[model samples]
Every structure is written in C-alpha cells, then in structure tokens.
Target: MPPHHVAWWRPLFLIALMPIGVLGNLEGDALNAFRQSLIDSNNVLESWDPTLVNPCTWYHVTCNVQNSVVRVDLGKAGLSGTLVPQLGLLSNLQYLELYSNDLSGVIPVELGNLTALASLDLYQNNLNGTIPDSLGQLSNLRFLRLNDNSFTGNIPVSLSTITGLQELYLSRNNFTGQAPDFYNLSKLENL
Candidate 1:
C-alpha cells in the first residue's frame, strides 16, 4: 500500500480499538466518582487508583470475564458519603453490596439504570430520604435489602412490579402509609 494509504489506515485502526481501550476507563470513572463522593477514613479504597485504566484491578470490585464490573463488595468498609449518580454507568453490574456502612443520603435515582442488578444490599446504613421510585426499574432484582436505614415515605408502589423478587427487607425504616401490595412478587420467599 502507498504511504498515504498506510497513514489513513493507522487512524482507522486506532479508532477501531478505541472502544476496547475506553470501556475499562468508563467503568473506572464511574467508580472514581463514587470514591470522590465518599469519605474513606480507613483507606479501604486505597487501591482504587483513578489513574489505572481498569477498576477491576482495584480492591472490593469484582468484574466479569469481559472486564465489566459485576459486583462491588464494600460492605462494612468504614466509609461514609452520598451515593453518586455515576454508579448507574456500570451497566453490567449485577450485585451492589455496600451494606453496614455509615453512608447517608438518598439512594441515587440513577441506580434505576442498573437493569442487570440482581442483589442490592444497602442495609444498616444511615441513608435517609424516601427510597427512589426509580429502583422499581430493576426488573432482575431478587434480593433487595434496604432495611435498617432512615428511609421515610411510603414504599414505592412500583416495587410490586418486580415479579422475581425473592427477599425484600424494609424493616427499621420510617416508612408511612400503606405498604405496596406485593401480590405480584410470587417468587418472594422473604419480605
């Protein structure tokens, strides 16, 4: 090929590889957003170096074989802070375990974007405010533990749409009004 053709192909080649190179960084950016929003006194997140291209290499983050974040095991990590909206960017995330922490603030409505989520364990936190109705969007969710928080307001009626929900825990919250009729959650074994 001519020199001019070679130069043209080089740019195309780089562009083709761009998604692969940038995919990891996008997820890393999402996690970094969470890191920045939190106050980590014990430095359990010390390995979460934003400079790294892949957050999968960071502690407490679990990724799938494709290098997509699937689970975050940061429960009881002695951290506190509001959850960031960017967490919804982890499109493939299935399990979000941030329970037993000092975290406060409303659960981000953006979490509704995690359609792949199956387990969301935020129990035993200081988080307050009405649980976002957006959580009803998690159709794949099975185990949702938002118990022991300061959440107020009526539990979202949309939650009744999750037919696959097996375990739902909302005890210890300050919810008022009649709870949603969960007759649609036929798979529910615990509530």
Candidate 2:
C-alpha cells in the first residue's frame, strides 16, 4: 500500500477503535478513583495502576470480552476507606463484592446507577447511613447484602420494588422503622 493509503487507514482504524479505548479508560478511571479513596493496608490493590488503559489487568477486578468492567471482587482484602461515587460509572458491572472489609462512610447513591448489578455484597463493613434509595433503581439485582454495617433508617420501600431480589441481608445494622414486608418479593428467600 502507498504511504498515503497507510495514513488514511491509520486514522480510520484509530477512530474505529476509539469507542473501545474510551470505554476502557472510563472503567479504569472509575476503579482508580475507588483506589484513591481507600487505604490498602494489605497491598491488595497494589496492582491498580492508573497508568493502564483499563482495569482488566488490575487485581480483584473483572471485565467482559468488550473490556467493560463486570465485577469488582475485593472481599476481605483488609481495605479501609470510603466508596467512591465514581464506581457508578461501571455501567456493565454485575457484581460488587467488597464484603468483610473495613470500608466506611455512606454507600454512594451513585451506585444506584449500576442498573446491570445482580449481586451487591457490602456486608461486614463499617459503612453507615441510610441505604440509598437509588439502590432501588437496580432492577436486576438479585442478592443484596448490607449486613453487619452501621447503617440506619427505614429499609427503603423502594428496595421492596426489586422484584428479582432473592437474598436481602440487612442484619446487625442500626436501621430504624418497622420492617418492610418482603411478601411482595416473590424471589426473596432470605432477609
């Protein structure tokens, strides 16, 4: 091929790849933001290098064939800190396992933006505050565990609306108000 043809094809190819690159960057940035908010005493997050284009290469992170983030499995990694709102940017995320960590602060309402989420296990953390109503927006969520946290306030009635929810664990929290009936949750087996 002629040099001019090469030049023409180069730009077009890069443009074609731009969307994938951009998606990786977005997911990487979001996970990096979460890393920044934490104190990783166990060096569990040492692989979270921000210089990477995507978080797929990072430890405890999982991605799909499209290079989009799908799961963040950091359970019991001895991490302590607040959850970043940027995590909501993982649009394809299905599972978020941060259980058994010392993570504190309110659950970011932005997490509600994870519409594709199926299992969200934040159990055994130091997280406090009302469960965000935005979580109700996770219509696909099945297993929702917020147990052993310091969260307070009524169980968001909105959560009752998650028709597919199969496991709801809110035990050992300081939550107030009468327990919301789970009878409407046809798939719910544990509460």
Candidate 3:
C-alpha cells in the first residue's frame, strides 16, 4: 500500500470528528458558525491572528470570562454585504446588534441554532428577504428586531414558537398580514 494508505484513517477520523469538534466546543462552534457571517458583514475583522492574540477583545466583540465570544455589536461602521448562513453556529450568542449598515440578502435559517440567543437586532440596513421561520427555535429570546429594511414576506408562524419571547419587533418592513398563533409557548411575559 502507498504511504498514504495507513494515514487514511487519520483523515477519516478528522472528518468524523468535524461535527463533534464543531458542536462539542461552544467557542469553536460559535467561531465556525459566525465565520462566514462576520466576513460578509464587514471588510475587516478576519479570524484569529497572532497579531491580535485574542479576537474577543476586539473593538466590537464581547466575550465571557471564559474568553468565549458572546456578542457582536457593529452598528453603522460602514459594513456592507449579505447575510451568510454560518452565523447559525453561535449556540451561545445572546445579542447580534448590527444596525444602520449596508447589509443585504436573506436572513439565514441557520440562526435557529442560537437557542440561547436573548436578542437579535438588525435594522436600518439594506437587508431584504423572508424572516426565517427558524427564529421560533430561540426559546430564550427576549427581543427580535428587524425594521427599516426591504424584506418581502409574511411573519413566520415559527416566531410564536418561542415560549420565552418577551418582545418581538417587525415593524417598518414588507411583512403583510396578521401574526400567526404558534403552540406550546410558555413564559410569555410580554408580546
């Protein structure tokens, strides 16, 4: 057999570990998940570099004591691009505030992975498309804001699935119709 034959298992093992590697570690998963989204959201702010030492301490990045990224607030910093699907990987993300920018494209359905999200703010931007129904998956969401955009569609009934939702804002958009009534939603302190 060729020298690569025995090493085949190594690649296979690495491949098999990819998903586990992504999900097992929260910080790794979050970085992988938002990798593309962050890239699209701006012109700078690349992934980890020795020059930066730690990415969480960057201007807009916020992290917990464990050095795990938690929030990314980049509002009106001249960011421009479409929403990428990789953002859904941030399982621990609580807030994603990016307003008054020039972002466009569909809000990826992958964001539903952020079940721990508490707030999601994307307004006064150039975004357009359907609000992902997967948002209802965020059981810990307290606020969801998407206004002053060019989206065209009805509110996803999945939104009502969020039992812990306290505030839901979808004003000043292309949404047409009444809100749907989802089921099994508890802790509905506010609408």
Candidate 4:
C-alpha cells in the first residue's frame, strides 16, 4: 500500500469524518447532561427525532456546516425539570426559549457564559431561586423575559450591564428593590 493510501483498520483513514465525530461529541454531551429533562419534557423538543443520525436536521434545530446546535426553544412546552448547567456546552447557542413550561430550577449562572445569546425567555415557569449575577455577562442579549415565576431575592444589578438589551420583562416575579441604573444599556428600546 502507498503511504498516502487509506488504511481500513486505521482510525485516521477517514479524515473526512472529523466533523461527524465533532457532531457526535456535541450530541453525546447534550444528551448525557440533559437526558432526564429532555425525556420528560416534550415542549423543548416535541418533534425532535433523536433517532436521526444528526440532531441538526431535527425540528426547531439549526446548525452550521459543522452541525452544531445554535437554537433551542420549547416555549409553552409542558416540560418540568431543572436546567442543567451543561447546556452551556453549546458554545454556539443564540436563542433559548422555554416559556410557560412547568420547569422548576435555578437559572444556571453558567448560562451567562453564552456570549452569543441574543434571546432568552423562561417566563411563566415554576423556576425558583435567585437570578444569577453571571447573567449580566450576556453582552449580545437583545431580549430577556423571566416573568411570572417563583424566583426569590433581589434582582441582580449586574444584569443591567447588557449593552444591547431591547426588551426586559421581569413582571410578576418575586423580585424586590429598585431598578438598576440604565447607563450600560445604551441601545435599550423596551423594558
């Protein structure tokens, strides 16, 4: 065999499968981390066919050529469970909506790690616990809705740091204290 010839037994024989391998890694991580919640909540991925070879082709799922999950929305879904911080592993996630679900858990501080996030809606859920100050790190956030939940404690002033925020909905939560200064939110259009 030539030095450049593909070897059947060699794992490196299929260099083209690298991207598929990456997709598998991502899918495996997502499945492992949110296994229980995903299985319990149809709202998050009601039409998703996990049996498919690639998750990118599933309903409500979008991906780049690399087959990475960029959005996950299950608004008004009948889901119930805590949000696993491992969700932050989707480095490319931009939109995440789980509004009006039966979800109950702390808003993961790790979510603030999603620097590319543009929209986040978890309204009307049964989620309890204080808003994480780490959320202020979503510099690209344009929409934020966390209304009507059982969350308790003072609103995180750090959240006011999102410079691109347009809509801010915190109505009917257990939040207390005055609004944070709006200087960091220069492009804010609605609240």
TM-score of 2: 0.91
Give the number of the best model, judged by TM-score. 1
Q: What TM-score number comes out for model 1? A: 0.93
For model 2, give the 10-residue run with minimal summed lDDT: 1-10
- Each prediction's number of clashing residue pairs: 0, 0, 1, 0
Each candidate's TM vs. the true structure? 0.93, 0.91, 0.71, 0.81
What lDDT does candidate 2 reach at residue 68? 91
Query: Against the unseen true structure, what C-alpha lDDT does each candidate score?
Result: 0.94, 0.94, 0.71, 0.77
In the range 1-191, model 2's lDDT, one tens digit per residue, is 77876676788888998986898999899998899999998899999999988889988888999989999999989999999999999999999999999999999999999999999999999999999999999999999999999999998989999999999999999988998778999999998
Model 4 poorest 10 in a row by lDDT? 38-47
Candidate 1 residue 101 Cα shift, in angstroms, is 0.3
Candidate 1 wrongly placed segments (more than 4 Å):
1-9
- Tens-place lDDT digits, model 4, residues 12-69: 6567677757664666466446645654534445445555565676665677676777
lDDT-wise, the better of 1 and 4 is 1
Candidate 4, residue 78: the lDDT equals 72
Which candidate's lDDT is highest?
1
lDDT winner, 1 or 3: 1
- Model 1 has an lDDT value of 0.94
lDDT of 1 by residue, 91-144 (tens): 999999999999999999999999999999999999999989999999999999
